[model samples]
Target: MTWTIRPPRAEDHDMLAEIYLSVRRQTFVWVDPGKFHHEDFAAHTNGETILVCEHADGRLAGFLSLWPEDDFIHMLYIRPEFQGLGAGTALLQALPEWPQHKYRLKCLVNNRRAKAFYLSHGFVVTGNGASPEGDYEELSFCPV
Candidate 1:
């Protein structure tokens, strides 16, 4: 599928929120789904730079948000149906200075898929820590 990456507009928030809530509920089965809320998207990504991926048909496929100051990717969530279709990589590549600068993110230890995805894309585990949700590995992709 073809996808275009663009900065989000106010009108995109509702769908983005839904995508965030649903993907978290689906991916983080250990967490109580009730704890995930639509508003969490806004709260978590506030002040971050976000890039939304839209499919050729106009549906929003996924989004990636990052703290530009630290080159930290805060969140990268794609709708369940859209996973593995290149949206994640596209979003990552769309980031500012991608492949030419170091970028970092944390992935829950239990999320094998996400960890593998990042690793396959050249992210290496740089550190480890615990979050309210679970243990996580800090991963970074450093340009060679």
Candidate 2:
């Protein structure tokens, strides 16, 4: 259950991609997993700051990508089996000098688990809108 958070390396690309794809598939069941590939993940994550959570045995547990320049959190995903083990909270706390600042992210309105997690972690709903995939609620987390 212990995990280490570190910046992802090029060699970890495939494993990270799989973790990302798997979490998306499990959490967002409405998505077509066939439509995604490692290359697509690479393209979408290019230039972003990506952090990977690795278990004591070095297995990939989860990852979080941040666009610091825009003060936005692009993605945060924990493997289905790794949920509720403090990995997600650890990832958020691992960010460099981030907790004291405000950042924004969007979560699908149908994703009640994620919405509740964010709310419990201090993020407040700032607005709501619709996306091609589904309706989404925008949230902002500001440090107290």
Candidate 3:
């Protein structure tokens, strides 16, 4: 199925929040799922640029949020059902300066699948650090 990336509207907030909460609960098994709430989405993404990926049929498939000033991808979460369907790639490619600008993101060290995905997309490990979420690797990507 095809997907389209677009800026999210106010009406999309609740669904996006649910997507964020659900994906996190499913992916971050190390974390206490009870601590994640739908409201966390708005709090975490406040002031960041967010792009939503919508399945051709109009369902919200996933979303990516970034700090434009730092070219930092703070979060990229695709619904479990949409994980391998190209929604993440569509969101990244839709960035305003994608392919030309270097974008960075932190991938939890334990999330091998996500690290592999970013690496396959041209991101390289630049550094490592620890976060409350656990150890993470800083990865950056720029097509060249």
Candidate 4:
């Protein structure tokens, strides 16, 4: 099976938006349900690398958004049907190739699946951090 990773085009909005919305709702249950949308994706995706994995059959399997400064993985999501595939692993292995200084990100306290994913990828807990817009706490991860 082949997957394509390329710069996004305007037509990719719907697929990207769907993935963002899924992760946003699942990860940010405390936030507004509508936090993920086309405009939000368009705006945040600017000046960042958002990679989408298109399956051999042309399905939008998953995506990852990387912010080089804080090494923020603003989001990562795979369609429910596509979970457990190499899509997530492929997306993550593609990160170090990106230009970045400090590699850091936060995972929800209750999202063990996500935390485990980061852990397996060599991310370890450094300390605690909060969701800037809310009271939720996150177990911070750093690659060092």
What is the alpha-carbon lDDT of model 3 when measured against the actual structure?
A: 0.93
Per-residue lDDT tens digits of candidate 1, residues 1-144? 789999998999999999999999999999988999989999999999999999999999999999999999999999988999999999998988889999999999999999999999999999999998999999999999
Model 2 C-alpha lDDT per residue in residues 1-144, reported as the tens digit of each score: 688999998889988888877777778777676765666668778899999999898888889999989878888988888898989998988877768988889999989998999898999999999986689999999898
Model 4 — which ten-residue stretch has the worst lDDT? 135-144
Each candidate structure's count of clashing pairs: 0, 0, 0, 0
The alpha-carbon deviation from the true structure for residue 16 of candidate 1, after best TM-score superposition, in angstroms, is 0.2
TM-score of 1: 0.98
- Between candidates 1 and 3, the one scoring higher on lDDT is 1
Question: Candidate 3 vs. truth: CA RMSD?
Answer: 0.9
Q: List ranges where model 1 is wrong by over 4 Å.
A: none
TM-score of each candidate structure, all chains considered together: 0.98, 0.92, 0.97, 0.76
Q: Rank the candidates by lDDT, best first.
A: 1, 3, 2, 4
Off by over 4 Å in 3: none
Lowest-sum lDDT 10-residue window in model 2? 32-41
| Superposition error at 138 for model 4 (Å) | 6.5
